[model samples]
Target chain A: MRTWTWLHKWSSLVCTLFMLLLCLTGLPLIFHHEIGELLGTEAHAPEMAADAPRVSLDRVMEVARARHPGKGGMFASQERDDDRVWYVTLSDTPTSETDLKQVAVDARSGEILTEPQLDNGFMYIMFSLHVNLFAGLPGMLFLGFMGLLLLVSLVSGAVLYAPFMRKLEFGSVRRERSPRVKWLDLHNLLGIVTLVWFFVVGFTGVLNTGADLLVQHWQNNQLAQMVAPYRGQPPLTRLGSLEAAVSAARAARPDMAVSFVAFPGTSFSSPHHYGIFMHGDSALTSRLLVPVLVDATTAQVTDTRELPWYFSALLISRPLHFGDYGGRPMQIIWALLDVLTIIVLVSGLYLWLRKHRAGAAKEAA
Target chain B: MSARRPLPHHGGRAHRHGRAHRHRPLWRWPVRLGVVTLVGLLSALLADGFWDVVSWLALGALVAVCVFFGWLRRG
Candidate 1:
């Protein structure tokens, strides 16, 4: 018990300030899309017939290539909520990450609607801060480590809660007691109530930090094996029909919809095959995606497989952290939980500093 | 502000009313439920259409937690 107390105290002290920053930044991020739309930077697809015959995927690729001139299509993804639009991303090279651009294409007409203005504005600033503290991977990893400390603190705090509340009730907030006691009760009640939320978000948040590492692993392992047969083959100058490739992938995974497609030589695809990522329509299955490999030169379906468990976990963690999956209501719930977390952090800090001050005064006496 | 102060008597902290309710369930089970709720809510994000039940359940649980805290605060 003493060890648990020490753990809780030090762990909370170490990461309270950082967690406060995350909770603050994450609040606005929960509504970033709505905020973006209000800011007039939202890219909307032109309304079309609900059952209209859409243009071919190959035509969409052609339009994207024409718009970018020398660049190549890295990825194309349909909007999850709106089927009318498809986002096509292009870069200087298919594999390049820097200066990458995206175009929202009218799925029916194959015309560029608007270039989504992202990675700027106040939301972007908040996103960067919440994500990496403007320090990129190292910053993300540091926060992930802090998240670990937060988990330790939560566990330790829970351990202490039993003893502290042994003689008291579960949710007791002693308003008549010292201010610190009142805050402590409030903190414990809120913390325990939101324990599941804070832990899940923090855990998944840490998993998301491994996103770059996961992509790197997929590139070296699974992608390497899938494209091994074409090792000596030169990159195809004239790509086969994306429409045919997509059809072949659809044939492979009939129940699932094509969520995104990574063209040859892109980060998500190999040099010889197009990565057709298919996903289920259900809320749970939607997060799990399976990639189908199609021969770029022949547009022939090669192989399809469910991603390894860890990678699938990473896929699930993304939306879990963002709280955008269940619509506005879920985000609202997430925001409320975030507020509770803020109270926990602040009260924990206050308790520690107050304890230190009391100890110092006693020493002087 | 003393750590040595006695526990509160009113509100959510007053669990010592009856002798019958004093049974101590293992802390491991509550800890386990916390873990399940955590995973359930997170996995809720992946759901859509008919699978929205999980998401809804997760939301309901969170809402309940908030309401409980509100009641505690009010008391």
Candidate 2:
């Protein structure tokens, strides 16, 4: 126990400054969805024409192709329900070395709605820094290591809490006493109250860090089974109308909703399958459904089961990690919890510094 | 002055057995339990979608394991 207490104090002080910056940046990211909506930048998918024959996916592609003639590549189409905008083509041009363009097209009229942009500038940068420190793989790995240390610190602190609070009731800050004692009390109070929130966010973050690797593994393993039969067959032709494909997909799984569609030849979809993703009917599953791979040639529904366990877990962990799943009220609660964490961090630093000062004075005397 | 009794330590309770074997071995038990529980958590998360009942169960089990150790200690 004494060893754990020492470990807790030293580990926390080691990463205290970096984590403080991370927490400050992370707070705003928790509310990013709401803030994006407020800023009028949230994109949505246009509602399908009711009783009016739907527009053709080929037509949308044609319009997009005509508008941007120099680039002929079209990767995939993404539908955003809230903003009613369709992101049609992902393209690269010769003049720019690393610029990839995402063309947003109106689903109904197939007209190009507006210029392409990153999801959100400020929020994306902050999120990148918090999660990976913008250093790519090394940064992600380092942050994961830090998260492990955090878990250790959390456990040790809890062990020490009983000794500190054996007498006082929960929530006693002891503000009138010595500064170190006050900080310790505050730390215990805040830590216990927000334990659930922190653990969920932190541990899920570890899962999130492994997401890309999981996706690659899924593509190689489970997806291999779905594509093996069609290995030598000519690539399946992409159907002309996505709305028709969506309706066909819904007919197969009446209870499911169309989450997204992968164009044939795309990475997720098989060369012979049109991956039409659908989520569960429940509130929780609705946000992270597994894709249903539909054979584009025959319009036959092939794979309906969610991605293999690890991939699905990564998908589901994203919302809890981001604090975006629980609606506006939950976001507010998350923000409050984030502030409490900041206080714990600062107070912890204060206590360490005060102790260091006292030790120095004693040595001088 | 009247003879005074020692004030009780509010921290961990005094073990009846000698200090060497009195309470559960702190480092071995908690560290091992924490590691096992952490693995279970990662496995459950991988097996099911996040937010499933399995993840919640894993979390509850973790906290219970921690609290159980804390309860075993004196004060």
Chain A only: TM-score of every candidate? Answer: 0.94, 0.85
lDDT tens string, model 1, A1-365?
77888899899889889899999999998997788689866667666669999999888878877887888888989866676788898888886857787888888988888777545669878988898998989999999889999999988888787767766665568878898888878777777777877887888888887788987898788878877788888768878888899999999899988889998888678888899999887776877889999998788888787888878879878887888787766778779878878988898888888889999999999
Instruction: Give the alpha carbon lDDT tens digit for every residue of B1-75 in model 1.
Output: 123323445545363542214434424434554765665575556445544556666655755765565354564
Residue A33 accuracy (lDDT) in model 1: 72
DockQ of each: 0.29, 0.05
Kindly list the per-residue Cα lDDT of model 2 for residues A255-292, writing each as its tens digit: 87666666676667777677777776565566566677
lDDT of 1 at B17: 45
Q: What is the TM-score of chain B in candidate 2?
A: 0.35
Q: Report, for all candidates in order, the number of backbone clashes.
A: 14, 14
Give the top-scoring candidate (TM-score): 1
